[model samples]
Target: MHIFDYSFLDNGLLPAALTNLTANIYALRSASGLRREANPKIFTELEQVARVQSVKSSNAIEGIITSDERIAAIVNQSSAPLNHDEAEIAGYRDALNTIHTNFKDLDFRQADILSLHAQLLAFSGNDDGGKYKQNDNLILEIDSAGKRRIRFRPVPAQETAEAMEQLELAYMEARGNANINQLLLIPCVILDFLCIHPFRDGNGRMSRLLSLLLLYKKGFLAGKYISFEEQINLYQQLYYTALQESSRGWHENTSDYAPFMKNFLSMLYMCYKELDKRFAILHGKKVTKKARIEATLENSLTPLSKRDICAILPDVSPTTVEAVLGAMVKAGKIRRVGQGRATRYIRT
Candidate 1:
């Protein structure tokens, strides 16, 4: 389906969920604009932890096995991968690092995506890295008896390049129209990408990498501070179910995007919520009430009304919350998302 098709937006993604996702996406954007940390060390520490978890969780989803300690060591640059699985894990870490360092400058074009895929599978000695599948591949599900059956058939090998080119063009065209929010559009695009299954291997990991890249490009930075892949891994079965549900009739351009979009948005919301709790734990004791409030507002997954703040911080008075929120709004640390009683505060 092309970007102009109504199915992209009207195809069953819940309206309520879309509204909620929009708010969270905006909140994350505001949080990314946070003042240079009062202490950069804490965030750096968390970033490393998040990176390790992301690498571990993403690789683990592919049945790649290694001790947590070893993964941590590999991520920390203290050790080399010991086996084939660990080597693939290391490749993931390297690809992730490239995304982390260059997401700002990267374009989600065919060559860029292929380059990351190559980087993602660098451990493989053959030349499959960064290349489309040269032959048809089946997505299979193995039964309890170890009998594997095809679950889906993707675009034919010869059509992979043309399919991807059209998909990229569709996305670029959609992006030019401001009415289509990229957050919602991204999940749909990922769903189509998975259904296409353009590459020979590593499609799952590549999808997650693309998720982070798109999130960063859209100005939502929660994936960096909290592991998006980890959150998805926590509910891996649901992840597959959602993808399957959304891709049911994808080849015919008659499927629902809601299932996967719901999962995607839920995963994103979890990341922001986790970021809030982590910040409160790491900085609450050291920072003042106002700073804490600032952190809360910035880290919030949704715009929080004054009553919401009071609810979250009962130890602090309503007056204190009000004053802090007011100050934050004035200083551009946060913005009031609505007017009067309906108003809720979010990062600027």
Candidate 2:
């Protein structure tokens, strides 16, 4: 005898919000492409390095970061008698690589996405891969005595599958309409998924990957292009805080997702802004070899050698630097002193 209130669907605000979010995403993508076109070599090289680093760091922190040091270390090192870390990292990397390579072809279906989650959790080495929980999970809170206590209980194990199915169905319905903002839909699905606590472990990591996958499917690949996970690492505390805030009293809880949504949007915006700035610096205007070398020397506090210059300016060849240095010496932008490996460049 329960009646559902569908007023939120009729308000028209959700559709409008989604439209604006999609438009902004497109504009950001165009700007990103323009920057890439301007500085293809440097932008591509730095981006790949950054992405790998981000993924590694995020995977390392996993469950250990949230619970206890011993637990964290065990989870991170895969030495806690569980030994699932390697498997988890591999699965996550595979999922990421797949998304990066075939972003456009992603169809956003439930089973396919769940399989990715299963792959991600395969590292947990648990038999629950791609399956819902069979028993109720407890949300634990720590007391002053350092004892763990159950704070909130979830729906029964038998009902877990049904709950997840409903959430997935809602997600599909929302996605199909296209008129609904994908941004709103993203956080909604993420929060609900966490609430379900579908898998036995690796839920947090899977949730994050799912968020990125959804974004890639919708063309917000700019975040991945510049390492959104790195940005999250920088604000790890806030990241967890937002998750905890969203999940508090989640069941029958009139909790507002505004805080979590705000943080998510802010992180996305920051990543795009940083990428934009980097693109501008790389492609804004071309500087001659001499000018570039002089600028590099002046900006760096440490003394630079030929090898260091090569590392910093990967786009410029070693022979090119040697040629540029010879010209610069004649032009007096730098004075090379000493001999062989001992030689160093100082701004004149």
Best by TM-score: 1
In the range 1-348, model 1's lDDT, one tens digit per residue, is 323243345344457867777787678556644721554755665677679879988998989968666887888789988888888888899999999999998877999999999998897564788999999988889999999988888888998898899888877877777667778888887887888888888999999999999888987778887789988887889999998888787778778888998889889878877776766645565677776677777766555678656545556789999888888878888877768766878776
Tell me how far the alpha carbon of residue 64 in candidate 1 is from the true structure, in angstroms, after superposition. Answer: 0.4
lDDT of all predictions, in order shown?
A: 0.79, 0.63
Angstrom error at residue 129, model 1:
0.4
Each prediction's TM-score versus the true structure: 0.78, 0.68
Global local distance difference test of model 1: 0.79
Name the regions of candidate 1 deviating beyond 4 angstroms. 1-7, 10-14, 35-39, 144-147, 286-348
Per-residue lDDT for 69-106 in model 2, tens only? 23324323444323455456556666666666776766
C-alpha positional error of residue 341 in candidate 1 after TM-score superposition, expressed in Å: 50
